[model samples]
Target: MNHFPPLRLLVTFEALSRHGSMRDAAARLNVTQPAVSQAIKALEDYIGVRLIDRSVRPSRMTEEGELLARAVREGLGRISATLEDIRAMQTDADRQITVACTLGVATYWLMPRLSGFYDRHPEITVNVQAPASDLPVLSPGVDIALRYGTGGWREGINGKLFDEIVCPVGSPDLVARLMEDGVDLDTAPLIHVRNPHNQHWAGWEDYLAVKGITRPRSSGQSFNNYVQAMQAVIDGRGLMLGWRSITERAVLEGTLTEWPNGTHDLGTAYYVSTGVDPSKDALLFTQWLREEAT
Candidate 1:
């Protein structure tokens, strides 16, 4: 390996790039502004390139400086992430299972039913993670994942949770008004959920096409996630495609009303998948999930 700048100097430079001002970086690192400037100078001397362009009022990064800053930022980020993962793996090994699922499933389906699991196995803890992608996969540090689709996943041991039944649902008032007006699916204000990661799920176009109905040029409001769309539906904004696992409880509780004639089987189902080397605790929780789904 070649000679490199000190870790402290690189850290200071990284802070300077992030905060965009020596004073701010100094305050963040709990040091004087002159100390921040000195660290940047030391880093530049070691790298043999002008990192900060002090010619400007606020002190901007040169082209090389920008490139170095990006590298440092990514490098430090990865290091921090890896360290956290390592610590989690060490501490979370005993009696803990990390389950990843979509936000909709986590919020509406899994969370409402977790009390039973805890009741049965008080010694074990289940950690639920809802990734921003809205799609859950068996990833590192994640013991199990609840995935929704027609089962073709080749990653780990897969178990069927339940077959997905997607139906259009709306508030009770909206459903009553629409029914009274004799408004069918074609003319009703339909809330749509669309996101890049939601490809596994059905959208308005798919649902309409399946029912042989054509949506008009003007459509309803669009949201990126199910939570927001469901909120709109609850508020009587429009109808939304509701999955059986997510909306069944709400429907039963009268929070939302489903159109009996609008139900469709999209041939998709939810599956619980475990990592290649799943922990015993993960298997235990997976069994509970199967029992609940059944």
Candidate 2:
């Protein structure tokens, strides 16, 4: 019979050892300190050995702890990488094209352009998944990702789709309501998008600065995607700094109106990224994406 510590216990042990404190490890794993300590205790009990030197002020690793921790870290890292590789292989074998994108681009941009692809490639079926910012690595199911950010991803081909321009947008009725309520542009509730990238474009601050309006009274609410933000505007929730490509159609349709003529060209651009060996379907889909975006 094989005897081994549970993977969960091993992960906890590895985290605790590396961080050298139950509190820190708990924070890293988004769990309580007591939970982390319990995991450590379980791991030690399973191994029938003390892995940590808790007597020390800051906590230290015993000789056995050190060796186990190293092995666990290396083993977990390899397993994670291997899982990703296997997923990519499965994606390739499925002959399906998976696209990862921001909600705004998916709803506003891609949805409108999808018919063109369907018309041209009847044999290929494509799937679209949106707002995958929290994903650490592209999953095996994802074949291509249409990401908006600075160019140069660590592990995929990055292609620029279009430049982004931010400008305030709202419905005509909402703007009228704000005006009637004596709410100025600077004091309007600003809707923000909570993007996956930590570094994001500044909306109200940049808009006010260019207009020479300082210290505007503002309340900010965030959405996970541009589509949601636009919906809020349509629903009379608040005004948002809208991306031009995603908002232009709405503006033309009179569903949304652009507020303030000033537009800031955000340096970041949209990209279509793929794994090292993308399937032929993914390649074709990417080619179609590039042709459409350009």
Best by TM-score: 1
TM-score of 1: 0.69
Q: Candidate 1 regions off by >4 Å?
A: 1-92
Q: Give the per-residue lDDT digits (tens) of candidate 2, residues 1-294.
A: 269868889888888877878888999999999999899888888889998888987778899999998999999999999999899777755666778776667889998999999899876778888744523235677888877668777887667877877778888898778778888766787787766563455556676787787764446788866667888989888888787878978989999888756477768677778888888888888888888877
User: How many backbone clashes are present in model 2?
Assistant: 1
Give each model's clash number. Answer: 0, 1
Q: Which stretches of candidate 2 lie over 4 Å from their true place?
A: 1-94, 131-137, 176-184, 194-201, 206-212, 216-224
Model 2, residue 89: C-alpha shift (Å) = 14
RMSD of each: 9.4, 15.1
What would you estimate as the lDDT of candidate 1? 0.90
Residue-by-residue lDDT tens digits, candidate 1, 123-182: 898889999888898888789999988898999989788999988999999999999999
Note the residue pairs that clash in candidate 2: 87-140
Q: Estimate the TM-score of every prediction.
A: 0.69, 0.59
